[model samples]
Target chain A: MPGIDECLLEAMKLPGARGAAVVDWTSGLALGTAGESQSGDHEATAAETAELARIAAEYQSFAPADGSDWSDDDTPVEDLIVSSRDSYHVLQFVRTTFDSSVFLYLWLGRTEGNLALARIRLREMARQLVLG
Target chain B: MLHRLAAEKATGSLMRERGTLYLSDGQVIHAESPDTPGLDVLLTAGGALSPEQWGEALTEAGPQQLVGRFLVDRGHFPEGALELCHLGALYDAAFFVLGRGGGPARFRYGVAHWMGAVRPVPVDAVQRETSRRREMLNEIWPEDDTDTQPLVQTGLGLDTGLPRRQRAVAELVDGVRTAADISRALGRPAFHTLVDVRRLAAAGIVTAARRPPRAANAPTRLPETSAAPDVSLLRRIKNALEAL
Candidate 1:
């Protein structure tokens, strides 16, 4: 599995990828970062994205209502995507045995970035991203 | 002191009252403390391994100085999970070790932790991460005393908006158990539990007893009792077994 730095480098290779970071949503800390941050401040972006991820993941409404058991194995939500006129921000949750509060944040330039490709690639990267 | 050791490319264990940090070529390879659960507790308490499994691994690899490799080779857990847990335990212990003020620290050259090295982090990185964690707590709630005191609910019904983790922490707050105690009870990392408790305090969802004043001229001698069994002899026994 690719570690945080390797995964982040792979993320930066995605088309129009401007910046990428592995953020622990629980602590709002950036585990790794590459390229220019969308918000100029990587720390601020990490904290903001964590807030968004926390809100989305904690709400019961985000999970499927089929009366299925709620567990870490069952991801409450997949990737969270936010788009502005000029850019796209993607937060892909990474599941771990201990906590699932980490995610990959990718900022892409809208004019050149492919949202669909970034989303798919980020999900794949999240699966392979190793934390140590 | 660590910076000087790192500069000299020193090897061995730095023993303090709160914990022990193993360094190899100036890099931190392992750490353990009584205040925080070690890697063994993290794995077992987190339900990653049974006590029997851990004991077996210890028996097989503790002497060989390859317990980390043994677990991975035996498919007990993935390399990633092992490293993550090891790192978590290391930092958690390091936090207390660093915070232990005025205590004498002893360093023995060429010593090693029985578990061996899963991953070695730079001395600087460990220090930086510890400071970052401290800053995070301060940013959330400026009061440091709340960390050591037993938690008490405000009884103001202020928990309606608490997150699941914080709520779980709140439920464990019996006005008796401190944050570290609750952390063990929940099988969560001490640092993470502190973060949650700080958040709860920041939100006025919970309150902590007033911190007592420290005595002037308190002796800096290392505490005689530790929270966990001493594993030094186990390492020696394992060494003998490996020699056989």
Candidate 2:
């Protein structure tokens, strides 16, 4: 299985990859970051992206007629993607029996990305990533 | 007839000119309106599915059985989650109705939505939690417009003796930050961050910024990310009377 750096290196191999980072969505902490900063404030953008993931989740869990349970702990999240005119922002959530709180964020160019292949590659990366 | 149809526990696309609202048992389970960002945005944002997964789900389902199961199925979201999404979809559609949000839309009723083997959350509890959030916000600002406006924190500076968490918030007082960003910085849960922000906002500790004027004629773009507190967010927190 590829480690964190290898996971990002693999993502950079995508057609229009711009930047990549492994972020803890819960903490807005970037374990590792590569590429030019989207807004010059990597920490701020990471926090904002993490917030987006969270609000969307809370909104879903609170819909009317909902019958599921949300344990009094952090829910496991999978992946998140935010598409804009120039780039695709991706967040992939990872879980290990020992720990399950890290995620990977990949930003790719809209034109350069082949949506299907990028998805497939990202899925593969998630399965193999090893975190410290 | 549709209301009656819903009462009968029917399933189908309940399309409206504005958008289509879906249901399984008089209670809404899934919704889609072309004039809005649609379910993909909400689902992707919520971390339930990746953009690629959502696309695949759309292609695989072919719009009828697929969207329904994608939402209702156990693996995708809990029933509470679907309901919340359904509401968001409706809100998005309602916001875009008569606007340029485009779609050839129609609602079909009486067909089984067949969301695959999903579990349900207690609706009442979720509603209560949301209401609690709303009330908390109201106590802080008591206004809806503040929600849409840019969030900026203009203060003197963080006091030295404050607790780490409050200090963290004080650090963010310079520029406007979102609840999500604050959550990430403090390493706290989103809800907890929201609660504190509201408390701070209510105590007159935080002031809401005015909304930006809408741009017209130009290709619309999302707002630029705001700046962070850099020794500038704090001003008078150190010496002002408790009343101020």
Candidate 3:
């Protein structure tokens, strides 16, 4: 029920959360953003992180060994976690009804953020995001 | 031209040969083109909403210029799904509109689309993304023929382990679907379709089929999104998957 802004605001309430964005991995655009971005520019962060998301989503090597079939609109790989020295970057793939190319990106500080909680919360958020 | 309009804080539609840009207070609120699928197609055709649902929503809210709000209020999905698709469709069409510069255009002051304002983009951002997208496509494959011309599988063979999207693009190549056509078929952004086509071309998986010359005034047909579902195409895909 939470819209992009509301969802992002909710993300900001997470411990150690610094910034959040809903990004399209295909075109590298930030559809919506909240909090403070790592690079001080949400668009730049979106474009740069999209490369990583695309790599993970599209590359065959990232597929599961079980070999379950997946369409382009649905990436089997759910979330990508990149940890830096000071913070954790979490990219959770959001499923839409059509062309699910978006992911929720959360930038969290290492000291205060609970990685497990963020992962669980983001998955639920991704699952519930309706606008297909 | 659009930049000047942006400076003037113009509100209306900038009509061009390729597409139209809907500006509100100098910001781009919407855009559409013959070369790209609109939000309705992106939503319904892409399987986010059924055609019936879309038809109903349009019938109810389109006249009020509140389809975006209607979709949001309906709460079928979660939130921000419309915005994501809206931005994608807007940028896809705006790319074509931006390309039509240096030509005569018909600008109407105080025009707006029925979808209402989902989100407005700055003139600078749209232009920046358009150029970047152009460069990105060129970087993949310089030729633009695969974009506008009918596509046929080269049958020279495709690389193993192609990405899922490119594989879907590969499946639809029967010498009739252009990149735009395939975008309509797949219900994704035209830019994504073109990007996939260019990559497939680079991999020798698909190629643009040449057509005979036509007279200058003979208009090239645009893909009709309102057409009934392509049962044959779906059948072919279903059969192919079964065979595999």
| Candidate closest to the true structure, highest lDDT | 3
**Weakest 10 consecutive residues of candidate 3 chain B by summed lDDT:** B231-240
TM-score of 2: 0.35
List the candidate 2 regions with Cα displacement exceeding 4 Å: A1-132, B1-21, B31-49, B67-133, B139-141, B156-197, B203-205, B211-243
Candidate 2 chain B minimal-lDDT segment of 10 residues: B116-125
- The top-ranked prediction according to TM-score is 3
Candidate 3, A72-99: lDDT as tens digits: 4454888999999999999998777776
Off by over 4 Å in 3: A66-75, B100-102, B211-244
Give the residue spans of candidate 1 off by over 4 A.
A1-6, A9-13, A32-52, A58-70, A84-87, A109-112, A129-132, B100-102, B213-244
Q: Choose 1 or 2, whichever is better by TM-score.
A: 1
> Positional deviation of B84 in candidate 2, in angstroms?
11
lDDT (C-alpha) at residue B7 in model 3:
96
Q: What does candidate 1's lDDT look like per residue over A20-121, in tens digits? A: 987767656665689999779886788789889877766656655652222456465788999999999999987766532578899999999999999999
Q: Best candidate, DockQ-wise?
A: 3
lDDT of each candidate versus the true structure: 0.77, 0.51, 0.83
Better of 1 and 2 by lDDT: 1
> What's model 3's overall lDDT?
0.83
Q: What CAPRI grade goes to candidate 1?
A: acceptable
